[model samples]
Target: MHLLIITREWPGYVLGGISHHICNLYNEVVDKGHEITVITGTCPQSSHELTGKKPPANEVHTVQFGYRKGYYVLFPIALRNYLQSFDFDPFDACITHTGVPFELPLPTVSKRHDCYEATKEYIRNGLSFLETIGDRLMGPFRTIVDRRSIAAADCLIYNSAVCRAGWESAYNITTPSIVSHNGIDTSVFYPDSGYNKEDYILFVGGSERKGLSHVISFARQTKEDVIIVGPDEVNSPHVDALGRLSSDELRQVYTNAAVTIHPAGWEAFGNVILESVACGTPVVATKNCGAVEVLPSSACVVTSEIERGVMKAKNLNSEDCIKAASKQTWDKPAQDMIDIVRSITNPEC
Candidate 1:
């Protein structure tokens, strides 16, 4: 099968949730003996992101997109204009970042990683007063785009059930959809001796939306070390900040920590939850996190009581966490996607 995948946020450039999903999914699909053509936008590399890989030669097409911050609103228009002159007849199907303004003849799957509703929670995290007001004023426009993106696709693939449900509640969407949660880069993250049965607690989050308040509560109560990853700084004496780590570095952190706490209140799906457990560290997340759907109480606990939850989860059998994570590898989602596409393209298979 030949697949045409389009995204403005590609991995190895912009490091985020969607990029990891695309990179891992694309690799797994390629290994399954399928051809892929990727279309992407710009995300300049930094010193720490580890360059040397780009979109595959001849298979990738790039458009000089100008508004990086406004990509969500502007990218669809850019893609629509670009696709007007291009021929997509050769590809069997296409998967887009979220949605295209115009529909394609081939089977179209929009990767609804999250909905606009998710952005509203940023106000609680760190959005400035102006930004919050702007978000409020832009509600109508955002709704239009959201509805179009879903309507334009033949199907929508949500990264989590929470995300899917959010979209349903926000838009009352009748679009055909399926939940396909994300997977981790198993090459860099797996059960290892990185922890060596250590006693430090780990918290990975970039902003307050990732349960920063809850992390502070955990840090204040626990006498153990609290290692923080992603935030620029945390003034607490109990916290040690490791701002922005590479995948390998992060895997070590996940491994070394006695438990990784990700009490994200606004999360659709917590990839860190999967990554932590995959590295033999149990996680403490909330019921709001969609990834908890696959994890057991021994591997993850869904509660707001950070201290007790960590106590319940920290010493869970490593094998159980590993077993749960093993089932959600890139290969699993890739195969699920292929099956979805086949079901759509070949109804009688």
Candidate 2:
């Protein structure tokens, strides 16, 4: 089957869980004997040519739309024309990884990464009424565009039950939705990485939405050695501030740390939770995180209650944690996605 994947970004081209998800899906789908072509946008500073590790010299081509860097919300005329002019021929199915050109004839699927209803909550953490109003006024335009794109799809794929619930509640469009969780590369995120175990808690920070403040507060109250690695280290004593480690480096952090922490109120699916468990590191995270689906009771202490999490982290069992993480891998979920795409295109099989 010929598949046209329309996404906002690609793996090496963009950074985030969404890109990781797309790369895994693309790799697995192409391996399973299907022609895959990816169409995505680029920043103003980015090279005009699409670049990434090619897969098996197969029939997969990437169509890059814009330059390297610019305002993320607006689309350039060139990008708009390039996207709108995409021919719906020679493809059995089309999947919009993010909002792009709205109209497509083939059996279309749009994966909803995060529901805007809940995302607004995170955005309005401590904003005043006027500030909140300003954000809300600006936010719904994007939401409308997303709604139009997903509403046009034959199927909508969600990463977690929480996100699915939010979509149902927010949009009232519940036609053929499925919860296909994200996958992790077990080979890379495994338990025995041979790194010196650091006697400190590790918190991978993101901006406000990721609840870095929560991690900082928890660390300060407990006075535990906490190393943070991500976009920013927001004022914490034990923070090492690695500031965006490579995938390999992340695995190292997972193996060496005493515990991995994720406190975000709204996460579609927390891949870090799975990475931590795969590295034989127990996670002290909120039950609300999408990783709760894959996380074993023995592997993680799932609660927002601070004392419970701290206590659980202090007494995590390594064998149990490793056992739990063993269930998740890149292969299974990747295959599941392939099956879904196949099912959409070939309903007879």
User: Of the candidates shown, which would achieve the greatest lDDT relative to the real structure?
Assistant: 1
Give a tens-digit lDDT track for model 2, residues 40-81: 655544332224643332333344545432222343234456
Off by over 4 Å in 2: 45-80, 124-135
TM-score of 1: 0.93
The collision pairs in model 1 are 195-256
CA lDDT of every candidate: 0.78, 0.71
Model 1 poorest 10 in a row by lDDT: 46-55
On TM-score, the leading prediction is 1
Taking the candidates one at a time, how many backbone clashes does each contain?
Answer: 1, 8
